[model samples]
Target: MTGSASRPRAVLIAGPTASGKSALALSLAERAGGVVINADSMQVYADLRVLTARPTVEEEARAPHRLYGHVDGAADYSVAHWLEDARRVLAEAGGEGRLPILIGGTGLYFKALTQGLSPMPAIPPEVRERVRALDLDAPALHARLASVDPETAARLRPSDTQRLMRALEVFEATGRPLARWQAERTEPPVLPAEEAVRIFLATDRTALRTRIATRFHVMMEEGAMEEARALLARNLPADRTVLKAHGMPWFARHLAGGITLDEAIEGAILDTRHYAKRQDTWFRHQLKGWSAMTVEEAAGLLATMA
Candidate 1:
């Protein structure tokens, strides 16, 4: 076996957007005859393919790929939902004795694989809507959560609307604080620690920011505006998962005459730069223990293994 005898062979290729994560994963999969598994949250949904920059069809044909572009936009897919999907794929891949390569930039997906997830049920859409309508005003919503579930409320930052809403809903539905429920449901990680080698692509932040900005420009040149326009014209509320895509809001601003196309495109670049910075920060501190390698280094490393 490629991995420890007790655990199935697996490889993880993770990094920020526009960092060539998909290419690396595909190369590794081709070398090892491994199956590529999607680990990015956005890439799971069926819609927003061009926006999410999912793997191209030619790339999928180069290796066995799973879980890419599988769900519809209407689904409020959570980490729990993704975990369930991954667990099934892991089991299936292990049974077939095929190496599994989990790849993408969504940090939470990797976190769930390694550290295990809290047993929180999906929060209702209405409850989430109510929380979001509170409009990122931390103090006011914090005050509301404090009245009903002070323990859970105490742990959340005032601006954490998504989490605060989840905690509040759990309290209302179960008559218990969300923290208490988390305590009760902690379980062993589904993906064994020794089964996989974790590798992170380390690109220079400045270089990566330039790449992000450049890619957004390419996306625009490649009909991203039309894609965004169609998606926006769907009349889905701003809070819908599809409408909240990273580049959508800025483009929507342009569409609504709030800004010019030039300004909107510039905003997209700036936003992507900031997103890359955040991803770099997360990979550094949050994934501190993982092996860090450059793109060239990764290619060399895979060559050796092959």
Candidate 2:
């Protein structure tokens, strides 16, 4: 989190989808002579750029943007990979005498950058496949995890398959609990939170829901389905994160003739709303000491920082 005696190193803009985060990031970058580095997991994939609502060509032309749409759809991109990319971008921005404006809806990226991520060993491919193939219900798997890694199991809810499976996979691969690896992290924080302007956009819940639905419909109209069609043609692994991007699976179903377009739209809208809610909840609890404000308020605050 070190910065020059004169100025902070970066500005972090975090919020739920459709919360105007991209606009704010662009505004801040324009003002602060910064480069916009992506923090969103979905935006990293090249295949679902429109579906992920990445910045448009015009918006990007206005400023230097890095790490967006740089990943292939079939690659198993992870948070660790993003962290490494972000570190390099931050260095590049610094060397260019520009601030690094990290923006996205993903809280984990912010957490990893600020708090430092555990250099946990990778799970073997077979271990990943074995865990993904298990059809056990959440509670059953939680019970199994409880036996091998009771500490992590107790911390996570029974319904949280993502974390539970990750913990199980880590233990199965390395014969050590995920918690143990996390506790042994030796890396320093990537970006010190104390030296950054951290802004979280908290919009009106009903208005956000409206924006999510409206923007999703816009994506459908603006070639999101075509993006999905191309991605489907690739036949990427189902377990890949790109396949689970908000509304992606529903759009895929629609393209496959398994569902009506209207139904697909409704399902995508519902899933996005759920995801946004989770993002809001996670930021509320996980991100501490960040100033939560509306888009306009954030812009005004960034002016002071500039």
Best by TM-score: 2
The parts of candidate 2 lying over 4 Å away from their true place are 1-7, 118-134, 137-183
Q: Write the per-residue lDDT of candidate 1 for residues 1-306, one digit (tens) a residue.
A: 245433337777888788888888888788777889998867886767777788777888999899998987765666667788999999898898678889887776787677676467433332344455556466777887898778778888988876776776655333456766677866677785555778899898788878887777777777788888887777765445666666888889998999999998888788667676677677677664687999998777666554
Model 2 per-residue lDDT tens digits across residues 117-175: 65465443335655876788999989999998898999999999998999988765445
Q: Indicate the residue-level lDDT of 166 in model 1.
A: 71
Rate residue 93 of model 1 by lDDT. Answer: 85
Each candidate: what lDDT?
0.74, 0.83
TM match of model 2 to true structure: 0.82
TM-score of 1: 0.81
Model 2: lowest-lDDT 10 consecutive positions: 118-127
User: What local lDDT score does residue 299 receive in model 1, on the 0 to 100 scale?
Assistant: 78
